[model samples]
Target: MEPMRGGWAEEAALAHLLAQGYRLLGRNRRTPFGEVDLLLEKDGVYVVVEVKQRRTGRFGTPLEAITPRKVARLLACARHLLGRDDLPVRLEAVLVHGTPEAFRLEHLPLEV
Candidate 1:
């Protein structure tokens, strides 16, 4: 497998989200547990996002890559970033797939 450029996918996801009216809060927010790919706010609600991308479906869709263990880690990281575990914040996954010239982005909200 070729090395994937995560930054490229992340940038695509960020631009897609922004165009959809989400306000950016942070990107690549790190914690001991994991990193939140994108943290956003809209309509006074916070969203913690995970971005997954693939150059092709020869393996699987980007959404298929998100395992339960990853979700747990993402939840923990989001909690750490917010300094609480009970926030009503929502979790979302952004899937970016395809080639650079014809990339496709999909948002799966309420992931957690």
Candidate 2:
């Protein structure tokens, strides 16, 4: 997909999270090494969510896009976010795709 399409997918992911009762803390939060797509707080836990969206299966599914390296970046961002004595947190991924009215959400919770 193009850059603009990717941006819209992210926006749609954020909206989906909000609709699911996540309290948005930040978006595209940057660190010295990487950036986090969404920082959310829910049920008293800080959630570092990586949003993935795919239009077709020719390449791979969105979930397959997250690599160990990407998880490392997410961990780094979570550490930065936690430096302020915030809530206990975990790393997660939100896979979003499908029609606008029927998107998919896969919350793969990581132990932290």
Candidate 3:
């Protein structure tokens, strides 16, 4: 995706999360493992949100874009940032479908 469009998707995802009472802790945080799209906190639980956007399903759905390797890297990055493996960390996904002006966003909790 284009950087500008990706930025728009991230912003939309952030807005959606904020509306649901999730506090933003960080965005585009880089670690040795990988970059985390969004880090948020809600009810004492830390969340690592991976934002994905797709114009169409010709290739695959937005959620399908998250590979297992990507999840591993994100988890490792989150652990490194939090400085502990025992902390309660939740993996989530923000799936954006269609263009920035007309899109459907879905937030789903992921377990892996």
Give me the candidate number with maximum TM-score: 3
The per-prediction tally of clashing pairs is: 0, 0, 0
Cα displacement (angstroms), candidate 1, residue 16, comes to 1.3
Each model's C-alpha lDDT? 0.85, 0.79, 0.94
Ranking by lDDT: 3, 1, 2
Using all chains and alpha carbons, the TM-scores for the candidates as numbered come to 0.88, 0.79, 0.94
Instruction: Compose the digit string of candidate 1's lDDT tens values, residues 1-112.
Output: 7755788888888888899899999988889998888999977778889998888899998988998888888888888998986776888998988867788888887455
Task: Specify the highest-lDDT model's number.
Answer: 3
Model 3 residue-pair collision total: 0
Off by over 4 Å in 2: 1-3, 84-87, 98-103
Per-candidate Cα RMSD to the true structure, in Å, reads 2.8, 3.1, 1.9
- In the range 1-112, model 2's lDDT, one tens digit per residue, is 4465567667777787788898999988999868898899888888899988876667898878998888877887888867864558778887876645566656676544
